[model samples]
Target: MLITLIILVLAAIFFMNGKIRSDLVALCALILLLVFQILTPEEALSGFSNPIVIMMIGLFVVGGAIFQTGLAKMISNKMLKLAGKSELRLFILLMAVTSAIGAFVSNTGTVALLLPIAVSLAASFHMNPSRLLMPIAFASSMGGMMTLIGTPPNLVIQNTLTEAGFQPLEFFSFLPVGLICVGVGTLVLIPLSKYFLSKTGTKEKQRGYKNKSLNDLAAEYQLGDHLFRMHVAPHSPLIGKTAAEADIRNRYDLNILEIRRITVPQSRFFKTISQRTAPNTVLLPDDLLYVMGDFDKVQHFAETYRLELLDTHMPEERSAINRNSLDFYDIGIAEIVLMPTSGLINRTIGESGFRDKYHVNILGIRRKREYILNNLKGEKMHSGDVLLVQGSWNAIGHLSQENSDWVVLGQPLNEAAKVTLDYKAPLAGVIMLLMIMAMVFDFIPIAPVTAIMIAAVLMVLTGCFRNVEAAYKTINWESIVLIAAMLPMSMALEKTGVSEYISNSLVSGLGVYGPIVLLAGIYFTTSLLTMFISNTATAVLLAPIALQSAIQIGTSPYPFLFAVTVGASMCFASPFSTPPNALVMPAGQYTFMDYIKVGLPLQILIGIVMILTLPLLFPF
Candidate 1:
């Protein structure tokens, strides 16, 4: 019992520190328990095969399919159009949509999918992004309260009840309280959000000048002063020569940024091939060179080599050049911050061979308050340095996968045009509806887990996702591992009589006040614990205790279980409380105080609503 308590305390400390991954913390606890013979190997490993875990895996695939098919994006677009221009109306619509989608998808995925839309809407309305982002983050959490598969805590509590020899909560059992909270939350947030957010005037002024274009990016990095475009003449000495042979850098003191190649077809037969500049790339007739050099020197060199200087100041001409120079259909632009453990740290960009390794061109580097644009090849990389990179979406996606090395920032709006909406969207929607129906109405006699599994397989079979591998990659493995590792903690607690002890204490202290107060006390305690550690972990630890407490007090466990469910999902007081909150922090430019100011009141309001409503619905 002492060992289990120590492990739980240490795990909570580690989770609060936020330095170690939550899964790693849980795994370490599980390993310690196993090493000490606290649990048999079979008991410790059971979570890996739990039906709840399997169902979560399947649900991840379904969510991924919905994202890949752009159904979520389409819904967001429609919602934004309906929102019109009023900030209050937009806030309500955004919250409603995010909450609805969040109930079915991972909150992190829901936030990622809608972040671009939120930012774009904020821009169109000339409002500060901070005004809209936090609300969306909070709304996603509220949304997860509505369904069984909406959030992991919901499943954890349901499984706990089932294992306790009680009937599990139905699919829509949480709906009434969840809907009431969301409705009440919307009413409270519409007017109160502005007071907690950053003042609109300063933030808007700072962001209003922001533009998304290669040239604009270059300008921001102070590269525009020397950037020039020169066209290769048919008879020029560089016409038939490769970049290495031309010795443009050593001879002319210039670096070629890109090569713009435009092929005019004799008939409608061949397609154009756009390529980036490299040493081995051979120059051809009419090839436009985007080079960096002094204006006068570049002009003199261009005249001496019979090259035509293309005016870049003209917007239309620059746009045309960009269109024909790079295939934006397959390319994207993103900013990635180097993490402390990045391998590239202390290595010069040239030494690291960043372009060659990642298939991405480093456009500029932002370190501290300075932008390193010129002579970036020799600049040594550092942790926290942001790299503005341009590359194919596939390459960017690859970079994003290496989360240990880099943290990809906000949505790359420049690449938004390239995301082709999958045609299988309707089919994916139908499959989702069928899955919901199977769970809600028992239209299919199969277990809920089987229904989810079938939906995931059908998503792949119908090509709702690009491929099986894509669906596999979409699963939140960290979350799965964390849940699996923490499951054993519940077992350890029970074995040590800790759950019974805690439940007895709770009932002895609060039972005289009646089951409603006991329910409120459990909810409040769970909510406070979740503000630090994961809500899923909190649910796993508290659900059994709540059930045990109800039994001790001689009351039905449904209201107590419902309290645990609602409390675990009320993670609004801290930015680190939920994945969606953390994901939106940078984009929203929010502080710890922002969450406390906006979320604390809502948390209290929801708690009150839950205490008042759970008893009415479930009847202790």
Candidate 2:
């Protein structure tokens, strides 16, 4: 017991320090328990196969499909449109909608999907985005309390009951608690967010480029009149030569933006593929080259090279070319500012090997309020220069992730979100609704976890997500590892007699008053611990103790377990306590004190309500 307590204290210290990842801390604790022979290897490693962990993974994939298909965004936009110039109405609706979605989705996923929408709606209504962002984050957690799969803490409690051979909770067993949580949250947060977050929120930092569309970028760079397409005829001199060997750009004074060719025969769907024009890209007969230059120069180059002009835009064809030529499905454009510390600060565009390294084209350079369009290959890059880059959407997204090279302006993925497969929206909606129905109705006779797994598979099979890798990307592996690593901890505490010791102390200390006082003690302790530890981790550690406490007190364990889950889920006072809270901090320009001011009160009030209400609902 002493050994276990010491390891627990060390884990707690690491968790509070925030220097190490929470998941890594949990894994380290698990390893320590094994090394100390506190647990058998099977006992130590059992958490990886926990059904609760599996369910959480499935839920993440389903939630990601919902977002990827734009079903969530579509619903949010439609509902937000009804607010119609009323800030109060918008606030109420935003909270209600966020909670509703959060009830079924993971709170982190819920907050991420709705964060931008909330910010935009608040701005549209002439209100502070900070006012709505924090509430949305809180509402997502409140919403998670509604269903068995809403959050990991709720699942921890459910798993506890099932493992103890008690009646497991139904899918909607948390509906009432969740409802009250949302209601109380709505009532308390209105005044708190308004007064605390204030009207004049922190202004966003200025960037080199605004959130411009592809057409806007093309126009600003004067690409419309200068861009043209030509076909590589069988007899053309460029048919078998590589781009570098041909030296087309240097000879013809034309830039090859991209090369489009039919990789497969004509019968195959999506057979036509576009590749970025790198130095070694070899030209093939019948290849279509998208180039940018003056129309006369491009025509002269095409004639000289025996190429066929496919779409040479004269003065009258500029608009059509601008609208249709820049197909962003596979190829797209974004602006990236060169970092002062970038290694390519003094290199010419041609010498940087950017096309080979990053698989993109630097179409134009924006330097000192001037746009350089032509002869860009020889242009030397300067620090703080913003380059108009064109490449595959995936390549562009990859560039956004590399902060060491340059900073990508605006949210490129958010812009990609706007171009979601709307055709699959209905399919995704049906799959989601069917999954919900399967879980809600007893006639389906499917286990909740099984149902979630089935839904996740169907989401991938039905093309709700772009691909399997995309679906995998949706799962938060850090949270999964943390929760899975912590599950065995409850068993370790039980094995070491720590849970019994803690429960006995609680019962002896608070039992004289009543079960309600003991329940409040358990609730508040879990709530307080969650302010520093992760809510899921706190719940996993405390649930067995709460159960043992209830069993010892000769009362139903339902209320006590409910208290544990509720207290863990209702964490607010600290920004880093919950993923949703941390997610909105920068976007909302929130400080630690901001959460304390608005969230601390909500946290305390919700705990009081749940402690007073759980025993009545569950019949302790």
Candidate 3:
């Protein structure tokens, strides 16, 4: 008992600090339990083999295939470019994208991929990143409510109950409530985000590229916007001419982003001047060409002219300073991460003495709460400040050193990246829907996990995913680790009878009101804690306790379990509680109090909904 208490306390503290990695913490706890003979090795590692674990892996592969396909980018280019039209439109479209994807892929997966695009699009529109970012984060949560595989919280609850004894929920069992939540949530966000978010919401357009609207890309892109491989054949008519002389651009409307002399193992560089080159360069046979044009046009040019266009890899600077150092100041501007923990996490451009520190000038600063003058150097760092710094490459690298916590964003160079899907290349929406239908109807006679796995397998075999490795790369591992790590704590709550202890204490006082009141008590307790810790972590901790209490009181556990699940996920009151909160925190320039101001009311509203809805929907 004492040992379990020690583990519980330690787990609580570790989860609270969130400094150490959650998975590592979970691994340690699992080992400790096994060593103390509190659980058998099978029980300790059971989370790894849990059905949810297996299902998540397969689902990630499916999600990866979607990512590699660049479906979202194509979608974003169409929807996001017009974001300046209305805040409500942007909110609806962005959340709709996230939720739709969330229904198919995992919520965390949706956020990891969408968040950066959201940041960039928000920047493109000169809107506050906070306004859109937080909505996407919230959408991830709300959307996950729509589908079982949409988030780990739903799966965790389903799996835990199944592992304990009750039949696990079917993939679509939560659909009714999930859809309602998603619909209501999206509607609420549209009107709310403009007022609650959008600091310095400005309207801007691309400075130089008078490119056509994004609709063109949606209608045209096949694999990548600016990524393709081409080969220059020996007998090709333009073989010995200079690359610029090859008329690559004039002939195909293809922007040759990068070029390499080698045919195989093609590579990329930023689409900028490669200075210090030989005066009279000439194209050669077997040379690799990296170009960007209409996807089909590029492919057609590659095949028609025997030219190899390597995928245009836009090398974004990981550190704004490093990028700025590389003469990126020539064109690609640096956006300062206002907070020290931001990509510019620590050491202001000024205190690192950016000017004397590196001949760089601070262009602008986006404070978490309000727009501040760029000159606030002596200010102690806050969380979401975008400091637009101007510098040379050397100075930028100096800023992006090991001791600091800043990050840079630009062209995502993910070796971990799978080949994106070809827009205009055809994913066949009907086919995708059919796959989901197969799962919902049990025509495949397997779990939803297997259904998704089979879809990925078919996609690869049909060449939709391109290759096996590409499909595997799309899975989000952090979410899986979070689930595995939190599983043990949930188990320990039951194993130590700590759950029964807490339930007895609560029921003894509320017993006179029956299980309904006890359920409300459980709901409030978890909801309060969720305001501080992560929603997923909160859910994991309370699930076992809810279960034990329901059994002890001789009533169905659904009402109590439902309360804990919904409450744990209700993280509206504080930025620390959810990623959506943090994502928007920087843009809104809000203080901790802001979340409480708006969120407290919403939290109350949610509590009322859960109290009324759970019993009516599921029955006590």
- Of candidate 1, the 10-residue stretch with the lowest lDDT total is 264-273
lDDT of 2 by residue, 1-620 (tens): 99998988787677656677767888999999999999999998887887767776777787677767667667757766797667789899999989998897668656766775676576566678898999999999999999998988998999999999999999999999999999999999999998998653556686755687776777888887677887788999987888778777678767788776665443222223444556577898877788887788888988988988874443212111123365554567888999999999889998987777888878899898899988787899999999998877788889987899899987766575455554467777787777777765658898767878998999889767656888898787776777677767767876888765664565458866889999998888888767655678778888988888788879999999999999998988766577677667656767666788898899999998998899789997
Off by over 4 Å in 1: 98-176, 187-418, 446-448, 451-473, 513-519, 522-604, 612-620
Query: Backbone collision count in every prediction?
Result: 0, 0, 43
TM-scores, one per candidate: 0.53, 0.61, 0.50
lDDT of 1 by residue, 1-620 (tens): 99988988898777657577767887999999898889999999987897766776776687667767766566656766898667778888889888998777667556755775676677677788888888888888888888888888889888988898888778888788778878988887877688878473243444432345544454566656667778887898887788767776557756676776655433121223353545667898877787776787788779878998887664323222233232343455677889898898999877766566776767678999988766666789999999888666677778767788788775464344324334456777788777766764545697767878898999888766544677797677776776677767767876887765764566468867888889888988788767655677778778888888889889998888878878888778776566677656656766556777788899998899889988888887
Go through the candidates in order and give each one's C-alpha lDDT.
0.73, 0.79, 0.57
Q: Per lDDT, what order, best first?
A: 2, 1, 3
- lDDT, model 2, position 597: 84
Q: Regarding TM-score, does 2 or 3 come out ahead?
A: 2
For model 3, the stretches where C-alpha displacement exceeds 4 angstroms are 81-84, 96-435, 455-476, 513-516, 525-605, 612-620
Instruction: Please give the TM-score that candidate 3 achieves against the real structure.
Output: 0.50
